[model samples]
Target chain A: MADMRTPLSRARGLGSAKKGTEHFWMQRVTALANIPLMMFLVGALVVHAGSDYTTMTGFLGNPFIGVVMLLLIFSACYHMRLGLQVVIEDYIHGEATKLLALIANQFFTLTIAVACALAVAKLVIG
Target chain B: MSEQSKPARPLSPHIQIYRWTLTMMLSILHRATGVALYAGTALLAWWLLAAASGPDAYALVQEVSSAWYGRLVLFGYTWGLFHHMMGGIRHFIWDTGRGFDLKHVEIIARITAFLPPVMTLGVWLAAYIYPGAL
Candidate 1:
């Protein structure tokens, strides 16, 4: 196996497109980060369930919860955008359609991420 | 590399031609659940924004989400979230260059399939039954 590689091919490791497993690594990194963040989020929701707006805002106002939530939104959205791009790439055969879908995916994920972050910031800052 | 000149052959046997396997089903489910969560998180956003907007808005969101149909959607979303989360963990383990063994792969897929519903039920039960205790 050690002898089986062309020197150029062996060193790059990213293949021709040069993405170099970037998506794979990012997916794992975000997934690992999301585990605890999501747990915290679910906990917060459960604790605040059926409570009034004041209680929900108060829960999110706590600095630690607020920060965990921010991280969760950012990482989860990024991971999702990556996953969806792959999905679009795989199923959409038309090149132009695939590109448009990819762009729309990013736009949608980014919009959600921004909206969620703004909501968190408002709660934390107020 | 001409289109019409190429020999007649199936492009590739996608899901249509191949016998389904646990890994394949789980793989597809992972993506399906991911897409579901994409929408599910939109609900989360609505909740947050509703909270930020004011009491009236927040109450409306609360009323909507707590409605029977809303709860049903929420339940489905919960299952999707947990299922996708477990699937991520499985993929993470694979990224570590382990868990690809045939025996363990099936085991992991089975656990991934069953554990999410159990966790979702547990959370919902606790949330609904012991509202304040949580």
Candidate 2:
């Protein structure tokens, strides 16, 4: 058996899974995606910051804005999950607690993302 | 598997006496900013749900978000968002294995550290004065 990989490479937790660059790649992808999406979102937020009910719903209810919001929610939540996963792995020493926290982190992120998506969908379609 | 009562491995670098550098400070801030954004998303959810719910709810959220305390939080959120983004960019550059030189790294670190507040202020100003220009 010729295992040629360096100990340093192996120790780095390459992929944190089976040759898995998924987490690292996804984090960067979402980070890149967030740049432009945040611009769009910040613009929308500024316009709607102090706006009234009609103004708020009216802008958000637009099909374009609704789609963008959905995209942003998805990307941001995934990024948040990945980021928190790193934090959890680094700091949480107890195996059980780390596992629980990682699971909870995804669930929490999904709940927020879903809630936001539902709100946007309702505004858009209704 | 039997666990040893007195286990192995001592963690090093002696954290208490560690000298903080700009890059190190920004590295920690990135995670802090990330957690802040996680909490801040609650406000976004509230606003959207309020809009979906009705005018009353919408107005209520708006009232709170426009209040001084609300504005302060919003401003901090804005800064956190931008700063984390800058930190992300810096890391991305490093991930690509470019700009590891001390001078370049410090320059990027300084920019990431200092620019967010200014950007946040500029954003809010543009938000108020120009009112749709950004």
lDDT of 2 by residue, A1-126 (tens): 599988887677554476468888999999999999998998877675556677778888899999999999999999999988888898898899999999999899998899999999999999
Per-residue lDDT over B1-134 for candidate 1, one digit per residue giving the tens place of the 0 to 100 score: 44778567857655788999988988988999998898777887888888778889888898888889998998898888899999988887887899889999999999999999999999888787774643
Residue B80 Cα positional deviation in candidate 1, in Å, after optimal superposition:
0.6
lDDT of every predicted structure (CA atoms): 0.85, 0.86
* Native-to-model Cα distance after best TM-score fit, residue B128 in candidate 2, in Å: 2.2
lDDT of 1 by residue, A1-126 (tens): 759878887677565548877888898788888888888887767767777777788888888878888999999999899889888977898889988999999999999999999998998997
Error of 1 at B65 (Å): 0.6
Q: What DockQ do you compute for every candidate structure?
A: 0.51, 0.46
Per-residue lDDT tens digits for candidate 2, residues B1-134, read 23656457764755567897878888888999999998788888887788899988877886887789988999999999999999988888999899999999999998898889888998898778765332
Span of ten consecutive residues with least summed lDDT in model 2 chain B: B1-10
Model 2 gets an lDDT of 0.86
- Off-target runs (Cα >4 Å) in candidate 1 are A1-18, B1-7, B131-134
Clash count of each predicted structure: 0, 1
lDDT, candidate 1, residue B101?
91
TM-score of chain A of 1: 0.86
